[model samples]
Target: MPEREILALRQRNAELESRLAQRESDDNLYRFLFDTMDEGFCVIEFFDGPHGPLSDYVHLVANAAYARHAGIANVVGQKLREMVPDEADNWVARYGAVLRTGKPLQFEQELVATGRVLSVTTFRIEPAERRQVAVLFKDVTERRRAEDALQQLNDQLEQRVAEALAERGLFAELVENSVARVQVVDTELRLLAVNHRAVKDFEFLFGHRLKAGDSLPERLANFPAERARSEAMWRRALAGESYIETIEYGRGARLRHFELRFNPLRESSGRITGACLFIYDVTRQVDEQQRRLQAEEALRQAQKMEAVGQLTGGIAHDFNNLLGGMLGAQELLRQRLEQGRLAEIPALLDTAGHSARRAAALVHRLLAFSRRQTLLPQATAVGQLVKDMVVLIHRSVGPAISVQVQCDAQLWPSFIDPPQLESALLNLCINARDALPAGGMIDIKCDNRWLDDSTALALDLPCGPYLCLSVQDNGRGMTQEVQEKAIDPFFTTKPLGQGTGLGLSMAYGFVRQSGGQLQITSSPGAGTRVDLYLPRHGETPIARRPPSEAPAQVQRAAARILLVEDQAALRMVIGDVLEELGHSVERAEHGPAALELLESGYVPQLLISDIGLPAGLDGRQVAERCRARFADLPVLFITGYDQSAAQGDGRLPPRTQVLLKPFELPDLVDRVITLLG
Candidate 1:
């Protein structure tokens, strides 16, 4: 053995020892790095299987993180098929492709053993020929869940956006097609959008087309009168105010009206952005209102004129008939006196006086129908009044018609004019007679009634107790139209000259003036009924005096009487009558002369005066003056007019009596004798 060879061997041994120590140190550092990494690390070795090359793999190396993520311990030498049988083939195929192609592959998969999602990057181990793969992976279960949730949220958001766009499209369509003119403007008063109606209206008004971005004020410039108002409205809307107004345009048949509204448009931030204007045509509304008012006024005028004409004509016809009777009777009396027919004088005079009395009654009826007659209201028993008028009603209806009276046992009293009520009842009986040419039953019923709220509303009357006097007739019933106008003056259904038409009108007026209601019900085939609802009187009704057996013989008395009359013929006739009754008479043609005579100490036991004597002082004033001198003087008032003036304040002096004009001479004599007694 040589010494040099020994030395070379020792050196080689030292060098080999150094190289081995460096390799061991590098392997330890790599192992430490692999174990400390956050990502899971593993190395897989592939081999040929029954299917193909690189068909399966075995876990050759695994870091501590890989063990922790895979939820398996000691997995370094385990086959991928053994750990995750279901996914082993898939994983093997993926890693085999990377190993064979020398390409890196990234994918996400689930670990069945731990049920954790993993993001993996696979690459071939160092050498190209090596059928081995190194896997760098992370447990990304939480991140995957978050990404899935985000995707679902995005899908929902897309659906909501699509729905919102569809709704917006529908709203736009509705606005565009609306009948009302609609316009949208920017803050600068420039038009942004307009409905079809607005475009058409603008074109009609300005004779030009309108487009977006056109200034609203400029568009209205052609209508100078409306430009300022339109601008002001836009300004107000821009200031966040809303306004509405109505305006009229054009004239006559071409007239038009518009109701305009200006509304402020706002942004999501609640800031005023622009304005929206709406215009509605109101021409028909305005025209209809005007026409209705005009029609109502015209109807009122027509009703008023009809009432007046009817009243005038009725009064004239009635007066002429009455005057003719009186004039004819007087002419016959005059002829008898000229022929020296003394025996017929009394009968002729009675006939003339009767005609005059009839004329006075006609005047009274006229006044009653006009509602101008002074009525003496009293507590009148309705049942008694109806009973008393039964005979008169039967006479008026004639023998063909039967009259029946039905009254309550304890009938209520009515506050009304007794004479007027009797006249009204008589008129109703006559009307019923006229209705039935062939004849039918007439029924008069009187009863007490309590009107409730509903009843009062139906009758247009106050709620209270009332005395109901109903006159029903089973005769030729009136039609609806006739019933409606039955109470109108001179609205009779009778033939020409057969009916005066004032019967129902007079009764209606009398009943109404006494604070009552008159209701008539009838149909074409049904019977007619007239109901008079009179207000109940608080006081008890006074008992009426029975009829006298015969006229009492007048007792003769001598007394001086002052007679005041306006007409000379009447004064002389009355004076002669008073003298024939054994009373001295002092005559005066007028009120002043009568007063002068009385003032000159011509005192009398009674003062007889015409109520309507002409002059500065009326007959009533003269009588008052005479009474001052003679306190106990009796007064007898004779008048063709109403005695309301003489009965001032609804009362006359004590021992005062009123005798209507054209009274019988015997009745006059009897009154004078009774007053002088």
Candidate 2:
């Protein structure tokens, strides 16, 4: 061999040796990678079966990890169906497709034989003709359980979120429809949210609609008078203060009241972010309270008036009796002087006369307070009476007060004592004039009123048609306290010496005695109104007798008279007066004594008896007993406190006359002669 040949041969051998060494190293690295992999790796070979092509696969090679995952050792060269008899056919189908199409696939499955969950990936090995597939898998049973638990938790969380959203919707609906005016405002005083009521109320006050983001100041700018207060309240609330207040808004009939609350809205960190306003209308409630207060005051006034009436009536009755005796004695003494029998004591007689006249005036006042004054009641047109008194009322009230008399065209006639009624009108006018020292208008109105049960009950009067006489004045009105006692005797609002304190009391007594009702309505700074309700006289007005007419003089007659008197002094004076008038008089101390005489057949032509006689049998009873025997007997009643004797619709015997106490001897003689004749 040549030297060249030798060298070439050596190089070829070295190259061969190098190539062999590299192949060995590559094989060792591949074995190490395959054995040390975390995933289980296996190679499968497909074979035809009776059911279909590629129906089964045999494990040709498997890593150590594959043995652990499959739970089978020495699994190489074993068919998958044999190792896992209950395995689903879908496993074979999925591997078969990877082999046939030479595509990679990944899936998760449970191994029944090992009771393990596995994530599997398969791919066909190169060489289209070879029916072989490589599979990589990982045991993932614990990981799958963790994933399932997480999914359940996510589903529960979604359900809770949906419920929370539903609850929020319901709360929003309630706020929107609430009757109370609700609003939310930001720190900048801009409206964030408002309920239906808030919107409506805002529009009613400002005549415009409100929306979110509108400035609160702008909303209240129309009411400049209230804007400052509203702004201050809002600012306080935003500063974390809460407050509630009642605000009066509007004026006159459109006036309204609202209770408003401001509450600070805060964040979780306790910092105030805004304020919430809640408003509620309280107009109706306030009005109702005021009306109830007025009703209570009116009831108190009525009770006071009733108490005064009772007290005065009792006092007047006792005083009348005393006056009767004193007047009677004086009249008897005066008769003696007139006959020229007491000429030597003429100065004493004159002194007695002056005292008697003064005593009569006091008696008149007592009767007026007691509502038992002798009254000559006649039906008179009220409109005409008011027309007649217009001039006098104006003169009494003074020129400062503008007095106006308004009479309805169809004014009803009233049954009242003309003189007493005139006095009451004059008193009312003077009081009204004093009230308006600075000058104002006064209205005197006369009209007809038909009171129903409810109105009558309110006024403490009987239900009927009445003549309503109202005197209204624009003046410094009375307070609630003064109005309550206005009708009580001796209750006066005037200063000392300015008023007698009996003006209203006398008016009240006179009206009550005439079967009428009296009401006074007044309020501070609102002037006063006095209403006089007189009973309607549904008959034609009686023609007034001319004042020039004198009493008819009767011829002296000797008549048998049964005189019943309770007081000894009064009885003696009356008996002497009857005897002086040329009448045969029989006297009794009381009704029983008088009855004894009448029952014993002591018949008298006339019976003059005191109605308030002592004992069980009164003057009326004695007269009744006398009349039983002498049916034609003429009775003349003498009384100081027995006003009932004067009442009745022609029920008494013919020639019956009631002579009030304190009568003159001439008057008594005239009555006796007229009845006897």
Candidate 3:
């Protein structure tokens, strides 16, 4: 071989060796990248077929991450439709796009099978050994969720800032226009600006109008202390602190409490520029506090008065019992004396009976004053009720007081105890008569008035329309102090023995128990006016019917009557009254005895039992037991109490009759006859 041929072959062999080494290095680098990449990678193969429908792309290969995300045990050489049939249509479209264009495409989508939101990148990679497209998918759910949450937070912050700005605008307007004193000042404690109230108050105190650049500490002595507190407050506020404080002002001239506020204003640079001061005159609030204290004191006094009233009521109750025994025995003795041969003693016995009757009246008045009297209220016409009391009032006032009534033709009827109203009217008439040295006209009027919301608020009472019954006297009126204490029990300016000082109190209580309000308005020289506001019931008012010329005849009944009373004197008196009415009467001293009497072959047709018995069984329980035995039996109960037990709790049978104690003998007889029939 020649030397030149050897050199050329050697060069060609060296070039071939270098090319082989470089190709091996490139292969190793590609393999490392394909195996170690974090993002999921895969190849999707497509085929063109006659069906014209695209066959689902086949998964030539898938990385471990993408395989696990799809919950696939093994994804190598699997068709996309078989691995994720639900997502096959989407994969086929992307695969076709990549294969047809032989270009890369990128989009974002959520893979439901993997429960992952992914950013996907697909590209056509014409493999040297095979034709296929590689796809890359990366989970981006966390990043997307964080971005959405950040957007929501920004939106909420903007909304809150807008609301705060709105509130600030309103507050600024309020501060500028408010009657309270408001001002803005610099750190040097010079007055920058002030509301009209500040100018007026400061001028009133110092006799000078405050202006900008005015030293506040010199004009107002309180400004020094206020400024000191303001400085400390602003310092803390600018240092990222929030503060709220209340301080007192104007101590020397007049003791007035003003609400003082110190707030800092800042610029965008977060530096404090000035401070705002808000001063509110709390005089009305102070006055309200004082009034509340006074009301509390008055409530305590009222509680004490109530305690005294209870004691007085107990005494009156005992007095009524004594009066009962006395009146019953005296009447019995007088009746016997009238019938007996001891006829000469008739006048003496009559005089004694009159005294006993007076004693009973006194006891009744006492009970009324103590508010212990049981009230029996009924539907009553105001016009007629007032008319019925005219005669008695005329006689009681000794004809000196002329009664004049101006009743509205459409006056609403009232539900009240008739006797109590009569007493109240009579008491007012007498008082009016006494006020006038000579005769005077007493105006008694009833009218319908609606108390709307404003009217009720002015009166400081509940809101509702009510019927008003008013009495006005053309006589000397009481002073303001007297008017204030007029409804207090036993409080009177009259001579001690001349009055018990309970007439108005009883009237007030009766109205209250009737669910009405009693109000009095008077002045020293103006005649007194008393108004009773009662809740109006929407029912037709019944007028008084003319009485029949002849009295109605009594209806007869064969019902036997049981008279159970512990007091012997009352028992005998009641027995006599019942017998005279042509009825068989069986008497028992107590409830147990009455039960025993009934058990011992006495089936009384009616049970009339006294409530207050010495034995254990009360009238209500006796009625209960009797009702249990004979469900349809009629029971007439008489009691000093209000008989609330019979009214409530369904203890008494339906249609049970109850009569208050100390009723007249005639009244009792009439009730018994009515109930029996």
Whole-structure CA lDDT of model 2: 0.73
Write down the TM-score of every candidate. Answer: 0.38, 0.34, 0.36
TM-score order of candidates, best first? 1, 3, 2
Displacement of residue 202 (Cα, Å) in model 3 is 56
> Model 2: which residue pairs collide?
none
lDDT per residue for candidate 1 within 1-677, as digits (tens), equals: 69999999999999999999776643433343345444677778987777566777788878787877778889888877777778777887788888888777777788766789877766666566667777777676765664474343221100001111223332343344333577778899888777667787678666667777898778777788878877877888789887788987665665678888777776446877677777877665566557655654454334333333444554566568767877887888888889988798777666666656656655654444334335678998878878855644654567798999999999888889976787678778777877788988999998889999999889889999998999999887888888889998657787775555667886898899998999999987678999999998889987623222223445566788889888889899888876765678999888878878766877788899888867787777887888888888999999876666677777877888888766656567667776776
Best by TM-score: 1
**Which 10-residue window in model 3 sums to the lowest lDDT?**
155-164
Name the regions of candidate 3 deviating beyond 4 angstroms.
Answer: 1-377, 381-528, 532-557, 576-582, 640-652, 664-666
Compose the digit string of candidate 3's lDDT tens values, residues 256-345: 666655556554466765565656666545655576556544543443344334335444554566567666667767777778847555
Instruction: Pick out the ten consecutive residues of candidate 2 with the lowest summed lDDT.
Output: 155-164
- What local lDDT does model 3 show for residue 33? 31
